[model samples]
Target chain A: MNRRRHTIPTLALKELRDGIRNRWIAATIILLGTLALVLSFLGSAPSGELKVAALEVSVVSLTSLSMYLIPLIALMLAFDALVGEFENGTMLLLLTYPVRRWQIIAGKFVGHSTIMLLAILIGYGTTMAVLIFTNDGDTSGWQAYLAMMASSLLLGCAFLTVGYLISSLVRERSVATGLAVATWLLLVVFYDLGLLSALMLDEGKYISEGLFTTLMLANPADAYRLFNFTGITEVANLVGASEIKVGLAAPLLSMLLWIVVPFLLAVIRFQKREV
Target chain B: MNSTPTIELKAVSKRYDKLTVVDGIDLQINKGESFVLVGHNGAGKTTIMKLMLGLTQASSGQVLVMGENPANKSFSARRGMLGYLPESVSFYHHMTGLELLNYYASLKGVAKTEVSSCLEQVNLSASAGKRVNTYSKGMRQRLGLAQAILGKPELLFLDEPTTGLDPSLRRDFYQIISDLRAAGATVVISSHSLSEIETQADRIALIRSGKLVACGSLDALSEQAGLPVHTRLAVATGHTGRVAAQLEPHFEIQKITDHSVDLVCPVNKKISLLRQVADLGEVVLDINMNAPRLNEIYLHFMNGEKA
Candidate 1:
């Protein structure tokens, strides 16, 4: 029993080691940091006389960047996590151990969540550090910035779970990759596009305010957006949704549900998967 | 051998959707016994191993390891009692050999300190710090064996453990298996090409198309196939005719030369016939007996099944 409990940390540590050895963590940090720095510099160019604080503008731009990038990178990290093991013939050996399949899922999810979290910290943290040092704005803008970083990790967890589901459901690595990409397109890109088209078509006629909020929160990416952008005056004004009424509960809970439902399904599917 | 079986499959079968990969298989491997499962690729050897290891659930019937249903969630292979080496053994390419083995050792609840010793046992100590991607195929296989033997598992499952190994390394691999067997671990090995294992396996199960065609010790299996034990007799300068005359009544001549004759006799009768040839005294100067090979026995049964 003690050994069984120890299995997840053992496995998670190995996965983290793999990430470090392959330079995955380093590359992701550099990628995020560089992009965040670039967005901070150029994001204020189109303020159009609003003269909002630079850090607030950075939050708006970074949120948009993370909405597309975090989920995509999370999917990229996870598309091959299980299927690749099967292809490599390592899953068979791994299953012969005393660990359960759900432990494997738990361990990998924890490892990937940590990786994404680190990327967010060092990547956005650099920008945050620069903003503080430059006295770009008072510490008031730090709240939304910190919230965006936290919610970005949550969004990453949601997609990571979805990626595990895709990996567990498919047999071929190529199929997993294709399915992961297709899911990202459906959620991150097309969901918003489809929602925009509907709102334009409705023009405040058919889609009610509550329905619009539900629609936005249903997709994890939009949930992340609402969680980051809601209740922030500068960003809310920028996206032109000042009248939006939402507590911290709905989108946050929806984001967590996005993480959990697919995670549970992935565990179920992986439990029955033959190595 | 211990009376209790380390692994028992009673009419166990596994089906993947529309395909049946493992037919009803009933087998009992006694504790400390070394059993080999030999067949062509896709003939269900690996599937049977998977079933025993609880990597796959049997679609029908029962599979018990150490008297516990292996597929049950409560069954813990990590109590430091079970080990497995999969075919074409692969590792995280970015990890050093020591790192990979250490990870498995930790997963199997083995002491982390024993990792280097395990690598040394497989002659991988020198390369322990090198990444797996840089290791050769044989090196990877050695690393696999190293991890499989950690904790000195009581039951070890090896799927084609010796593939990609040279002749000397194959001999070393079997030596390690023999040592494990001597240590009272029930070992199950699966291989498609099995000639080198003739003397290593205490018993061999011949599988064909998800079915056990024949199983037993090599001598028993070949006898069941009705393969003959071949003997060659070389005579003195002028005794060939006399030796052939005496041996002709007892056996079929596979070949007859001026000075020697090859006789094909039933395995059970080979010893007696050789005694009889000795009884003939100086007529035969030399005698050579050939045991039927595993491949021959395998072909005989595979063809019989096809027919």
Candidate 2:
């Protein structure tokens, strides 16, 4: 039992080490940091009191950047987990250990999650700290700042789970890479478009409220939007009427479901695979 | 012969669809035994190793390492009982050799401090700090051996262990296998080099077309194959035709180009045959009794159903 407990953490540490050394990881971090910096300069609101506060200006700017950048970083870090190992022939070595397959998957998930969380924490963390320092401690934007971090983590966990699922489903790394990128495009971009078309075709009567509510809960990105837009004024209204009722309960449950379902499927497939 | 079987396969078989890769076969390898399995390509040698390590499941029958099924989720009890060196040994390219060994050792429940000594045993101590991707094939094969020997497993399964090794290094690897046998670890390996393995393996198991065609000690296999142990004789004069006719019924004369004639005689008939051949001609040429090489025995069985 002690050996089993150690498997997750040990494998997790290995994942962390591998992630830190990966050039893809370094490149992702730098690209996301640059995007954050660029968005800070472009996306800030001009009419608000935050105009004078460069830090609040940056935080507000990062709100849009974090949504896209965090998921992108998370996807890049995790999409190749099992498929990459399969290609490298190390998965066979890993399976020879006494650990269970689910434990291995969980360990990898945890490890990738840690790297994602740390990246978001550092990149957004630097921007937030800069905001607070430059804004003279106006701290009204602090709650939104922390909420954005939490949303980033929630979104990251969702994508990492998606990545593991892709790795499990596709044996070839090239195929896995293609499918993973397509999944990202669908979920982050096309999913909302599909939902919008469905809402329009429904004429806002039947599917608009209930289906939109379910869709918001179904797509993890929408769940992140729920958390970020719940307390805010303008963005909350623009999301749709059903999103107004999305509270801590629905989004949290949805995020938890996102983490559990795909990960559980990955573990199940990993257990049966010949490694 | 040792009594306890460190590794056992009971009517084990693996199949993919209609094709059987490893047919129903039973192999019992005792503790401290150095057993080598030899075969051609697609002869199910590596498949057996993978089944032994629980990296793959047998379509039927049981494979046990140290009396427990390797695929059991509660396999921690037997975790360090066996070490496996896969065919193409590739590790985390980012980790140094020491780190890779340390990681594997930690999983096998070895003390972290003893990792250095494990590396030393395989002569990889100096290269321990280098990344795995930087290591040559011979170096990687050494590292693979190092990892396999780390926890002092009761059984070791090596697949084509000397693939990238030179002749001297292959001798070194055999020496290491001998050392493992002396230390009471059962070593099982599969390779194509039968001549070298003839000295290394306590017993050889021959697999052809996924079936166990032959298996036994070298002498035992020779006896089973009914291969006449031959003696090469080089006589002093033109007695070639006379000696060839004299030994025709009892022995096979392979060549008589010069004064030398090579005749193969049954082990039991060699002494009398040598004397008769000597009396027929001047005994200037010496006699050398040749035990049938494993390669010959391998071809004999591989060609037909003799043994």
Candidate 3:
């Protein structure tokens, strides 16, 4: 058991080293940082010369940005994690080592999660730091900003875990990539549009308020948007939080479920795979 | 290194849907022996290797490595004692050869200091600092060999180890295999280059159409095939016809050229046939004997199977 524990760290270190050498870490940081900088600075321009705090306005835009960007980046980073290794023939060599199959998956998850966390910190963290330093904002505003950042990380983890599931379920990298893109489109784009259309067509008859909330929680992206936009009072007020029927804990728990359930399913599939 | 068998497959078979890749076959490789597996393409060679490595499960029968069922996850401990060089060796292209070796070394629980020496053993020391993508095919093969030998595994499986290697490098490869054998390591090699392994293999297994056609030592296989040695005697300028007539009654003449007559005789009758040829005096100018080679024995068995 102790030996198995050591294998995960070693494999994770190798994954990190590969990422660093290939400039993936640097690329991710630059992409996220530049976008966050653009969104934060431009987003605050609309609330200029108003009584509303600048940081609160930035948090609202950044939450929307995080809702779309974080999940996409997370999926891109991990969609090829398992199938790529198999296609490159490294999985066969790695499996021949003393490590167990679960260790391989766990190590990859740790490595990829760490990369995502680091990117979020440097990108969004830098924007928030600048905002906090430049303007004296209320304590609630800062607290809300921190919560948004944390939940954004959770949302990224959710998509990354889903990416792993796609990777383990497919035999080829191309198929995995296709599935990943389709998954992103479904959750990030079509799911919300489909839900809105259903609500509009129902006229509040069959799609009750309770069913609407359940449908929102069904998609991790929707849960993430609700958690960041409506969970906090300051940001929620800016994004019209009065209409939200579900509580904060439900969306948060669903996010946690998104991370665990897909991860467990991936492990089971990878364990039984012929490779 | 002991007398016990390092690997055993009993009535083992592997199938993919309707296609049976490895038919019911039994094989045992004892410790410290250099065993070679030779077969044509799609002859279940790689499938059998996968079975032994526990990369896949057998459809029926048993596969035991170091007295443990490799398919069971609990037997992963035995994997540490085994090394494999796949037919197509691939590495993280961005990593340097040294880094790749170090990565595998860590996975195998080997000392970091041993990485450099393993590179040296495969004649890859000069290119150790270069990234794997920059290396040539032969260089990559050497790096593959380096990684396989890194922990000095008790049992090593090399599939087409010498593919893409130059002649001298092939010699170097066999030299390493010999040294490993000297150190009492069981080595299993699967290759298409029969001449290279003919002198090195302690035992050989031939498979065809997903079945074991024959398995034995070189001499044993040759004897079982019962192929005869050919003797060619060069006759004097115009004595070819006369020599052919003289040898026709006593021996089976394989061919009669202008200057020589070829005769096929069993191993036991070789010496007497030579004497009979000498009695022809100046009719014979020079003599040459061609012993049966592994290629011939292999083809004989393969063709015999078809018949």
Candidate 4:
């Protein structure tokens, strides 16, 4: 009983230490920070023209950027979480330890999420800090900006969970890599592209407003988008998003579901998986 | 009453789809016994180990390790009491040996102090601070042995542990196994090359094509195999002719010299033949008995099955 408590933390800490050693944390921070700073510097001009807070305009740009970057990084970080262990032959020894399969999933999630959290903090935090230092005393957009940053993390975790599911479903790392890239193309790129095509082709004929609303939330990246964009009307208008049919809780709840559902499925798949 | 076995597989069979990997294996590994499982590649030796570890579930029948069903989803406290070294052991390459052992120690609920002792036992203490990526194959194997011996586990599984080890390293590996056995740890080893470990096994199970074809101690299997045991006798100069005359009637003479005679007899016939030879004690200068090897017994079994 006493040993079980430390199992997840032990595993999580190992992954955290691995990330630090591999310089993944540093790479993620640098990538996110450089991109956020560049967007913040160039994004304020639209804020002046559109009469929106500079931070809010930057949130719009970051949310769009996150749709591509967060999921890609999340998938890359964890696509082989289980498969790599199997490939390396470490999974056999890991299973011999006194740990349930779900704990493995939970521990990996916590560790990977920590890495993503750090990246978001140092990266997005830099932009928020610069905006505050240079701006008038209006702190109105900071709330949406924080929510966007948090939602970006939620988005990353959702993809991380999806990557775990991919890892659980396959035997080879090459297959996992291919499936992960396909997942990014589908969820981050093709999902929105398909939606746009559906909207263009449907033109309000076959797809209902509520159905369109649900479809947007069905994709986790868009759900994150709706969270950051819909809360601020000025940012929503700047991004040209149509009026959201659902309340704020809808996107948040959907994002939570995105994290929970795939994670549970991964655990189930992993439990039945033979080492 | 028989004590509960450390591991028991009752009619256990594992199949992946239409292919059966382990077929109705019924085995009992007693507490504190050193057991070896030997078979050719893809002969289901590793599958049996995996079944015992509950790394993969058996398709049919029951497996009990340390008196608990290892496949049970409820947390297994016994897992902390069990250790395994896979065929090709791998560690987190980024971690130092000390860190990796400490990680396992924490999971096994062992004191952190045991980590160093385990490293020392495997002769890895000098490089404990070095990352696994820098360690040589032999060093990594020793490190794996170090990990498997952690917590002084009640049960330890080593799969093909000496595949790439040097002879001296192999001797070191078995020395640790003997130490663990002295400390009452039940060790199960799966290997294709059982000849090297033949002397170390308390009992060995020979698996062929997913079925346990034969299992017993070397002598017992040799008996069951009906392989001949060789006996050599040095006779007094003039007694060799008398011995050959009497023993040739009951034994097959392998060789004959002026003062020495070598006789080969069936396992069952050996005792009686030896008794007859002992009657001529004064005439016989020395008597030597050589039992058949595990590999020969294996070949006999394989040939018999083939026939």
Pick by lDDT: which candidate is best? 4
Best by DockQ: 4
* Clashes found in each candidate (C-alpha, N, C closer than 3 A): 0, 2, 0, 0
Model 1 residue A220 lDDT?
93
lDDT tens digits, residue span B216-251, model 4: 999899999888988899999987988898988888
**Model 3 alpha-carbon miss at residue A22, Å:** 2.9
Q: Sorted by DockQ, highest first, which candidate order results?
A: 4, 1, 3, 2
Predictions: Cα RMSD each: 3.2, 4.0, 4.1, 2.1
Q: What lDDT would candidate 2 get against the real structure? A: 0.78
**Native-referenced TM-scores of chain A, all candidate models:** 0.93, 0.87, 0.94, 0.95
Of 2 and 4, the candidate ranking higher by DockQ: 4
lDDT of 3 by residue, B31-105 (tens): 988888889989999999999999999999999998888888997777777889999998989899999998888
Where does candidate 2 stray beyond 4 Å?
A1-5, A23-26, A37-43, A47-63, A231-243, B1-4, B232-263, B267-287
lDDT of 4 by residue, A1-275 (tens): 34433888988998899899999999999999999989887888767776778888889889989889999999998999999999998888888998888988899999999999999999999878888888766666888889889999999999999999999999999999999999999988999889989999988898988898899989898888888778567677777764764657888888999999999999999998887
Off by over 4 Å in 3: A1-5, A46-53, A136-140, A242-245, B1-4, B229-291
Clashing pairs in model 4, backbone N/Cα/C closer than 3 A? none
TM-score to native of every candidate shown: 0.90, 0.88, 0.89, 0.95
Model 3 lDDT per residue over A6-115, tens place:
67788888878877877878888888778877887787776666655767787788888888888998899889999999999988888888888878888888888888
What TM-score describes the B chain of model 2?
0.87
User: Over the stretch B238-284, how does candidate 2's per-residue lDDT look in tens digits?
Assistant: 76667677778877778885677787787567678867866775644
Runs in model 4 lying further than 4 Å from the true structure: A1-5, A48-51, A136-138, A237-245, B269-274
10 residues in a row with least lDDT, candidate 1 chain B:
B71-80
* Candidate 4 RMSD to the correct structure: 2.1
Fold similarity of candidate 1's chain A to the true chain A, as a TM-score: 0.93
Q: Compute the lDDT of residue A52 as modeled in candidate 1.
A: 66
